[model samples]
Each structure stands twice: as C-alpha cells, then as structure tokens.
Target: MKKLAFLVLLIVTVLSGTLVGKAIASTGFDAYSMTTHKIENGNLTNKVTDLISFTSQNIENEKNNDSKLVSINNVSDNVIDSSLSTDEEILQELSRYKDLENTYLMQPGWTSITFDQYDLLPLNSPKPLPSQYRKEFWSHFDGNQKVTEQVDYLISSETGKVPLGVFVNGELTSLWNDGQKVKKDPYTPAYDLYLVSSIQTLVESNSPLELSFKQEILANQSVSLIELRTQFSTTDKQWINIQLDKPVWGQYEKFTFNSQTGLLLKYEHYYVLDDMSLVLSSVTDNFEYSVASEAPSDVTNLIATGGK
Candidate 1:
C-alpha cells in the first residue's frame, strides 16, 4: 500500500496538470518514501541513482516497468498546410474544437481504450497492463478518480436534466430517476485516445503557441498530426536554461486526424524522462455521429444511491 501510494505520488510530480496519461517519474528527483515528494515553487528536481539502486524487490512487483521505443520523424512531406501564423490565425485554428461533447455525451456507441504506464522505481521490469477500460462518460472519471457518473444520458435540451444510472460489472446496480437536475454541468477529464482535449486546452488558454506539422504511419495507415508546444523561456527570469531533448519529464498529445474532415481519428499521448516512460494509446474503433441514445427502458426498481 505504501508503494502504491508512493507510485502515485511519484507520477504526480510529472502530471502537474492534464488527464490523459498518469504514470512514470522524471529522472531528477529523490523519494525517501511514497509519502513525500520534494518540490519547490511548483517545480521538482531529480537525482534518482540511490532510489533505483536501493529500492526493494518487493516493491518492484507492483510497478509496471514496460518500455516502448518512441520517436518522431519529419515525415511532413505532404502536410495539409493550415498556415496558422498570426494570433487570429491561431485562434481560428483552435476554434475548431468549440463544442465537442465529452466521450459519454458522444452518440450511444461503445469505445475501448487501454491506458498503460511505466517508470523506474524500487524494482524495474516491464509489467503487464491492467484491465483495458471502456469509457461510457458517466461511469468514467472526473480528474482525481471521482466525479459525476451516469445511468444513461437522455437529456432534455429544454429541461436541462439528464437520466442517471449506475452499473457494477455489466449489471445494473441502481439508477437515478429520470430528469435529475445538474446545477452546473460536471466537467470531464480528457481520457480519450485521440487527445482531442489537448487542442481544447490550448484553445482555452488563449496563449500564443508554436506548431509544426508531421505525418506518420500509425497502425499501418499514414496519419497527420501537428505538434503544438508551450516551451519555458530561459531568457525569462522565471525559467532556467535546460535542453529540450533532456526534458525533466515531457508529455505530448499527438492527435491523429482524418485530414480531409479535420476530425480526430486516434489519440496517442507519450511522456518520457531519463528512466521512465508512459503511453496512452486510444482510437475510436467506430463512431456513429448520427446516432442518439435514450434512457434504458429495462432499468430495475433500485434507484442509484450515490454517484461513486
């Protein structure tokens, strides 16, 4: 239990913010134990030789130490140039993600995603992935593992309420009566494979960004994606000089798109440091944009007590 908590604290250092990939530790920090992480002014430093050499094998059993070779090549030979230079152009480029509903709010189709993580700790060997997850929005998470869940969404655009229910292992455990009120709509974390929300993050930040386009073969077919970067400036008093290649820990959201329609095809996010790396690979196996879902007619008499 201490190791698990330590592992969680270890990764939290890198995932300061963001909801996609949630595992791995940067190279330059020391962990005396799982309970404490050394941080100053929201930034952490690293020098992990001792922990790697001294951690116990008992703890290694719990850590997933898998490693996959990750790289990016130019392949921009045929990028569909969306020349977004000026702020107005950037905003125009970002405006594309205006109202993409959350994964659950998506039409009533099913999605399967496998989220796996790796890192260097007391014991380091690639471990098997945990159970693959199928996210149905309402049953999914709110950033830190708890949030509003659903029964089945049959919202009334006019009444501003939605159908809510609960299930446990493919069985309906309970459900909320239809038309339950939601004071302020619950916000969802970006857990999709396509990393579409990364675009939303940049769009909402309203910050000036720099990007480079590329095309790479993903699962056989060529994919087009753009790298939008938010770099720390060394010249600024707030940031110190550091090489980009040796990022303490870097997380990237590589959104593969259907170039012609500019819609997300797959979500691939990668994070890496000197000793650990993490990946969240996802794709909508199939999406039915025109389909709409209604409340399940066969719900049991038991009403869902709490949205756990």
Candidate 2:
C-alpha cells in the first residue's frame, strides 16, 4: 500500500510541473529572455539572448556581417514596434505628479477645477440626493484660493447647506456657511483635493513595485491605470483614506491619470468582503480643469469683508 501511494504522488507532482511549464511557454517573449535586432535593410532578427549586457560591438558585427545571423523575418507589428515599455510608461505617468502639489495648481496662471463625490452603501443601494452626493469647486488666483462645497443635510436646527472654506498659501483660513461661523478643524488643508495625496507620496518615493500599471478602455477612451493595495494613513479626512475606518478585510484602489496633464481623471476604492467580492465604498469623478480669471465673486467678497 505504501509503495502504491508513493507512485501515485510522484505522478501527480510530475503532471503539475508539466502543466506549469506549458503555461509559461504559452506567454511567448514575456516568459523568455529574448532580443530583437533590426538590420540596415529593414529585416529583423530574433534570438534567445541572455538578460545581461548586449554590447554595441555585437550589434556592429551583426550589421556588418551575415554569417552569424541565425534567422531573419519580415518586420511584424505583433513582434516589435516603437512604443514605450510598460515600466517606462509607468515612470512617465509618475513624473506628472512629481512636481504637482495640488490639482488647482496645474499651471502658473489662474486655475479652476471641479469634481463630484458619492458615498456608497452596501448591496449597491441608492442614496438620497444632495445628502449622499457632494459637489465641489476650487479656484486659485494671485495668492488666494477658494474652495466651495455643496451638500444639503439638516442637523437639528442648523442646515448643513453649502460650506465655503477659504485658503491662502495652502492653509485653511476660515470656513463659513450662509453667514454662520463654521469650524475650521474639520476642513483640513486642501480638503477633498487630497484625493491624489497618496499617489503623490508613492510617486515621490520612486518605488514602482508598490504600483501596478495597465492600459484599458474607459468611457470609450484609452487610459493608463495604476493600482495599489495597502494600509492607508492620513492625518485628516480624505476621500480615499476614509474606507480604512472599517474592519477592512482587504483594500485596494485604482486611479487613472491623464497622460498629458498628470491630473487624476478618476478614482475608485474597493473593500474586499468575506466572500472575496469587491464592494465599492466611494468614488469621485467628473473632473474638469481650466484657467480661471479669478476666484468666485461671492468668495472674493467674503474674503474682502473679513468673513463678517
């Protein structure tokens, strides 16, 4: 009985190894250390090469002589083309956020940005309008910044209508709601604009492994997407960081960055449930950016009157 059991286990192990090898071989160049060379005549050559240095001398000899040429094929798009490697594309996207401190600071001139936020519920339940949905506008000019948030909810006597937070040089100066003095403690610096804070930190640290890169079709447009999974830390309320408050079994986030501008186009945060299903906790989208002549008139008036 012992001998029979040993034979069966050995056969199973051998089959598993064979299956894995076949899977690896199916991925083509992605699984092998191969190199493609272009000759002066436009023909191409592919060889199973070592991962280490392939010197200019080798290239010169390959071009000047054909004796060492093992095989040649016509130029094919499926094999090679002029496009940045995946890692290079990731670095290019990261560089966009390297010098960006705020979304409204996309350029030196006056800037304006607007976006909407939605707090989600389990089982994809619907939310009450204006209460669960929020709209925000941020504009910067000269040395002053204005942020206006709109949400309608009544707390006993006070109406949690629109709250206007004003900032100068990136510090929350004052907050007011319809002539009522609102606390500044809750409104941190940059407020909801902190959506990209974690991403900026990851980019600044220059660690590529922490971020996974991919390309996909979103809204019928091509976008470069980056994803990360880890514990989140923030000093104050930020859209993506709030999901950490739960007994999070697992958490991961996906962000799409505009290739040309480096601005965050969209963000989605998900919590992995016990059944390994993803429940979206929050999402922010409808990003708009443009040059502004100045801050909103009402905001400027409030600042001028010293928030009476």
Candidate 3:
C-alpha cells in the first residue's frame, strides 16, 4: 500500500509539472503569444471600438458644405485606349505628374467623402444612381508646393451604407462619418483639390492602377521614385502587392487601396536589402469584403459557379 501511494504521488507530481510547463510555454514572451493574449482578453477589440467611436464623432462634427454637385461636364470622358497602350506606357504617362511630398500637412475640406465596396456593380451590370456608384475625385492645389490629389467617393447627402472614414492629404485622417475633430493641422485644402483632379484624370482615362500608383508617389518616403510591383492572384481573384521600392514603410508594405472604391485589399510586400537584393516578405495580411457576393450562404454557390 505504501509503495502504491508513492507511485501515485510521483505520477501526480509529473502531471502537475507538465501542466505548469505548458502554461509557461503558452504564455512565453513571443509577439505571437502576446497577440494571442491581447485578442483573448479583448484589449485589441476595445482599441478597435475606441477607434470607431473617435471616427464617428469626427464625422459628426464635420461642417456640412452647401456646395452642389459641380458638373464634371468640362472633364473629358474619353477612356484611355488601353487596347492600344501597354502597361508600361500607361505607367510612364502617370509618372509625368508631380508627386505630393508632404500630404500629412494637407488641410481638411468642408465636404466629406466616403466609399462603399458593396456598391460595386459588375462591369456588365446596369448603371446605378450616382450615390450607388463608387467614384473617386481629384483636386489640384498650388501652395508652397504643387500637389495633385484624389479622394475615394463623396456622397451629396448622407447614406446609411457609407463607410466611416475621411482622407486628408490622400491619407486616411479620420474614421468618424459625422466628421468630428480627430486631428487638426496646417490643413491644405488646395492639396485635397489637386488630388481630386488627379483621380478624375486617371479614372476618365481608364487607368485605375495608375491612379493608385500616383497616390503611392504622393505618400512615398524616399529620395528616389518608388518602383511599383503589382500581381494578380487567379486563385484568389484579387490583386496583390509584390513590392514597393519606397524607403519608408507604409501601413502595409505591400497592400494598397482599391482604385475603384478605395477599399483595402490583399497585397504582398517585397523587401529589398542592400538596395539591389529583393525578397517577398509577406502576402495578404488583411482580406477585404468579397470582391463578389456578400451572403454567407451565397459564398458556396458563388465558389461553385467560379465566382470569387
């Protein structure tokens, strides 16, 4: 009986040690472990919530401008003959535009703009209302520097479906839809206007990717012009970022906004070491709303039907 009790005690001790070791291993000092903890304890969730609240307040506070929808009648609607133009030629043409160096200092406009990925209609689908259509705008500015700019979409009136966010100097400035104050600035309204013009030029020309690339230049941080690397995944039916030859890191080294809706999409980042070497560092960190259907039940059917 004494021997049996000793054996049981030894087994119990071994099991306890195993459990403690596992607990330590699971809570190790690695970033992944810490991230897991943050996710579990709702710290990340709360931070996201706080960010959303801050954005909502900012959108609420934005001064509603009485400006009517100005006619784009003068703007040429001639689609760039993509059939006659090579990608290289299109990119070269886009490169001719001056890049915005310090868009972070751009001023806020009175009118608010928003984008909705869900509003996208298939290329063959019937046309929707102006509000249902996702469009970007470009505005020109002449201040201390000459800068051209673009925004994702602007609704004439409030739409419940519009995503909550604001762009200042081509970068996301606020998340609130009501337009409350999130950040103040030496805000340059002219820069925003320039961007709006640039966007119009690119879109009307049927050069969506070029439009995105120009935005990259305005947002680039480097001595030399950044080299753009683009790729499309047939498996995923999404465009992926392969590389960006910029000096400073962006929010995602590879991913960028959708040219049509300004929505975030899966992108890859390529890292170059020693100025000449290259490597694909990461791919598709975030997935946006489906480029196709929305309903969960529809996903299976869509996939079976070869729709992404």
Candidate 4:
C-alpha cells in the first residue's frame, strides 16, 4: 500500500444566509467535531455537531473520550464497490462543461435558476429570520462570436425583496438599489450562483476541489447515490445524481448534472436535526432552458453608459 501525501480537504461553504462546511481531517479520515455557530444580527447561535464515522467497510458511530470517532482504515486504497461509479468517472463527466464560454456561445441558451432556502433549525425552534428565502437568477448567452453573457439576480431577505444587480460578461455592469446606474466591476460570485456555473466553477477552480472530493470519497465508506436518472418532462435527457451523506458539518448534499452536457441541473443541501430528521436548507434548480436573444435592458443600458 502506498502512503499518499496528505492533501487539503475541500470545504464548499454556502453563505446563503447561512454558513456550513466545517470539517477537520487527518490523513485518510475526516473527523468533524465542535460547535457550529451561526451569526445573525451580531448574535451567535450554536448547534452541537453530530459525530459520523466512515470506515472502509461501513459508516458507524463511536463515542470515546467525549468525542465522536470517524475512522477510515487503509482508505487510501479502498475502491468503492463496482456497483457505484468511481470518482474518476464523475470527474470525466464534469469535465465536459469546463469550457463554459465556448459551450454557451456554440449552443446559446438561457436558464432560469431558483434557489430556495428553508429553515435549518428544528420545527419547534423560534425563527429569528424568514422561514424561507428565495433567490433567482436569469442567465442569457448569445451564440455570437463575442460570446456575450449576462446574468440578472434577485434576492429575498428579511429586509424585503430587491434586485441584487446584473452581471454582463462576468462584470457587475448594472445596479438599481445602490443607485450606481452603471458600474463595471469584476464579478466573482459563488460557484453555486447558477446551475451551469456551479459545475463549471468546480471544474475550473484552481483549488483541489476535485482531488479533495475524490480523496474524501475514496477515503470513506459507501456513498448515498451515484447513478443516472431520467429527468422529468424530458424523456430524452438523462441526469447524473451524486449524493454525499454526512460529508461535512453533518450536511447531506445531492448534485444533479446533465449527463450529456455535464452542466449542473440542481444542487441540494440538507441539515440534520437532533432527532436525525433532515431539513432542506438550500437548493438551486435549473428547470428551464431556451434560446437566448438580444441583451436585456439592464445589460444594454449598462453598455450604453460607456461600460465598454
């Protein structure tokens, strides 16, 4: 057995009104313990971390020395059973969408992405924030030679609903609430901002997200789901589903990708409760797609203001 050099753990943090991904790892195993705090309005809310142990054979719970133990014995060489697709296969599928600028320009389509956030706490807990928060984005791409792209964002929060702004060609080109009229600042939003972008960013990231994810998967027990399923309303389209159980911060995540284009279709995160019940925390769904047309008023007006 070869002792692989320890690589950094990839923690994908979601800051959509909540924070997650708090995992500490040694060589081949990840042991997550400690308090996860949520800061809201200058106040802190604490939640006890659940102990989940992943082994080469299976995942179990071990309570010792007032700490939870998640052990992975000789996991560096462990191969997931033949029934499940290997991490390499998943990465190969993901690599297909790496060239976003080219893919969008060649095929040119628009997608409506809706992100829904639900109550993370238990049902009986007093809610300090809105029970549900909805954020939306519209990404348009013209198949022109210039590869024009524009994204519009709207967010609903405790203060109320408002249009976040617009990003044209990866630049914040427009603003309404801020009264900026025209601003062309480089925009580097979260990977999960859009469905296709989520996949593209993961593949294009300079960080070892793919390697760390593969190491984490191969360094553990069985995964929840890794298979292809037919998408609803589209019999010809197939989607690949990958679900990670208790990967980090006791969060369960499911990722759906277009089997053909490798573009992400959905990403879902669930919070585990004391009673072991799961609460959906956030989800981004790419439900609709259509051919792109002329630029929206936001993008056009921003360019008209000399944001050339």
Tens-digit per-residue lDDT, 190-306, candidate 4: 231122333334345432222213212321333222222111112111110112232212223455444444344444444344354443433344333334555456545644552
Q: In model 4, which runs have C-alpha deviations exceeding 4 angstroms?
A: 1-84, 97-134, 140-151, 155-162, 168-251, 271-280, 296-299, 302-308
lDDT of 1: 0.31
Arranged by TM-score, best first? 2, 4, 1, 3
**In candidate 2, what residue range of length 10 has the lowest lDDT sum?**
29-38
Model 3 vs. true fold: TM: 0.21
What is the C-alpha lDDT profile of model 2 across 1-308, one tens digit per residue?
A: 11111111100101111111011111110000010110111211211121101223333444476522211111112321225445446555565553343444533334544454433321111111231333344443333332222111111122344433443332332232223232222122232223244444545555333456655554555555666554322311121221222333344566666544556666555544334444444445556666655656665664455444
- What does the lDDT read for residue 305 in candidate 2? 56
Q: If ranked by lDDT, best first, what sequence of candidates would result?
A: 2, 4, 1, 3
**Higher TM-score: candidate 1 or 3?**
1
- lDDT of candidate 1 over 127-180, digit per residue (tens): 211122122222333344322333332223333343233432323321233322
Q: For candidate 4, give the lDDT of residue 7.
A: 13
Q: Please provide TM-scores, in order, for all candidate models, with all chains considered together.
A: 0.38, 0.47, 0.21, 0.41
The deviation in Å at residue 212 for candidate 2 is 2.2
| Model 3 ranges with Cα > 4 A deviation | 1-89, 97-118, 121-142, 146-180, 184-229, 232-308
Candidate whose lDDT is highest: 2
